[model samples]
Target: MDKSIEKKYIPLAAYFEAATKDKITLTFSEIETIMGQPLPNASYLNVSWWKKTKPPLKHFTAWTTFGYSVTEIKLGYYVTFEKPTTDSTSSTPDQDSNDHPTYIIRSIELDDARDVIGLYQQLFAETDYMLYGQNENNVSVQSFRKLISKWKVENSGTMLIAIINGEIGGAIAIIGSTIPRKKHCISIKMGVLEKFTNYGIGTALMTEAENWARTRNITRLELSVMKSNQKAISLYQKFGFVIEGERKKSVKIGSNYMDEFYMAKVFD
Candidate 1:
């Protein structure tokens, strides 16, 4: 981990509240200015309850600044889904009730970049304003390609995608260290399209990511989630993730501040 990147976990809720406050528009250019980097177009943002419920033609808002109009937002929980322990006796069914008959989950390859990008675009497009923060305009195929390229060069983790009816339905990226000193940890980012949600795609992607990490000897997984996203939080808890800390008002969405919950799962 980069010392400058801050190894501490940030709560997802805080991130949301800080990312969206009173603005009505957010764009890649604005995000780059705030994050100090060229943020991916596929990045998420959250819309506030006030904005969603009160507006006939509401615009986007920023977390800290109140005067700007954001055209898009990015919001989602960050969770670390871990591999089950070797000695654990808990049983996970090979197939869940929500698993689709024709969906295929597999490791990502270089040739799959196009599909991966497309799936990500769709996922971003379908994310709810309150759940993700931004609208569909933020998803960029070009930025997604860059991310895939970077991941390929590092090759220190796994990227898995779900295919349904011959089309990409979901994807996740798992990053870990191979160095002897840090082999026991991994980080994960999972996303599923709206149509695929509640259909076992998330569980399948998480299961595969965990298995991949275990194969590499990872014993702990860490992730962050929004405090307000009860659905994702519940899912992580069911998978054995526990709250480790909270980053108070770490993110500024618009005029309001939001907190993020840092959670972790240890598999010894």
Candidate 2:
């Protein structure tokens, strides 16, 4: 199990992991007791809250990481989790070990504002490829919280973060216009921590963002990368983005001016 699972859901995950039965049911209050906290109001009022096994709901990863999924939900009353019936019965250490590192890619939430801000600061300092330099970011926690809330309410954009080894290792943002004439286009910006690069974090984030765009009828996904960032340029090219043009001296890093490639991917 991923230790990065939310603290509140750890106990619940243990409860499910220890279960001998294939199916388990717990009421809202029962779940609250198991987690040592009250269920969020949305859990009681919204069915989507329980049904959505995706990000922005950290608890979903908790149960699913333990091989359980929400089989049924009674809205305010209770929910049931069931383990899939498969021919393979046992999971050994050898079967679990893989070459790649384990990571969770999910939509960003308000609680992640501070961690994200810190991540951006660290990323900016680690490389000049980033748009801002160290200490150049002035985004406040409250301001970031507002931005998250806005993303939740609007259909124009979203942000996703990759949680690796229990920390924010990277994030990607898709920014699009709400105007009817330009709704088909979106711009991408992302960064991975220096130590977390080459572990497929950026690729995973890009894959998720592109899946999201395709589902939303977004046809053009575009971004600008500093010309000197060959690693990023190659990654973009691998994902079908093409260099359409160049912006001369678009970025200034200290005393040096850097050109950037305007790249985009148009979906069929």
Q: Which candidate number maximizes lDDT?
A: 2
| Residue 246 miss distance in model 1 (angstroms) | 1.3
| Model 1, residue 19: C-alpha shift (Å) | 41
What tens-digit string does per-residue lDDT give for candidate 1 at 1-268?
A: 1112221111111222332122123233322322323323234343442134232322222221223222333453221112223444332344223334335566665556655666666665655313244453454656655666676676677688776433567777887775778768877777777776777777878888888777866789888776876887888888888999998976666697778788889987
Candidate 2 Cα misplacement greater than 4 A, ranges: 1-99
- Against the hidden true structure, what lDDT does model 2 obtain? 0.81
Compared with the true structure, what per-residue lDDT tens digits does model 2 show for residues 155-233?
Answer: 8898888765446779999898889999999999999998888888999999999988998999999999999999999
Residue-level lDDT for 40 in candidate 1 = 31
CA lDDT of every candidate: 0.55, 0.81
Clashing residue pairs found in predicted model 2: none
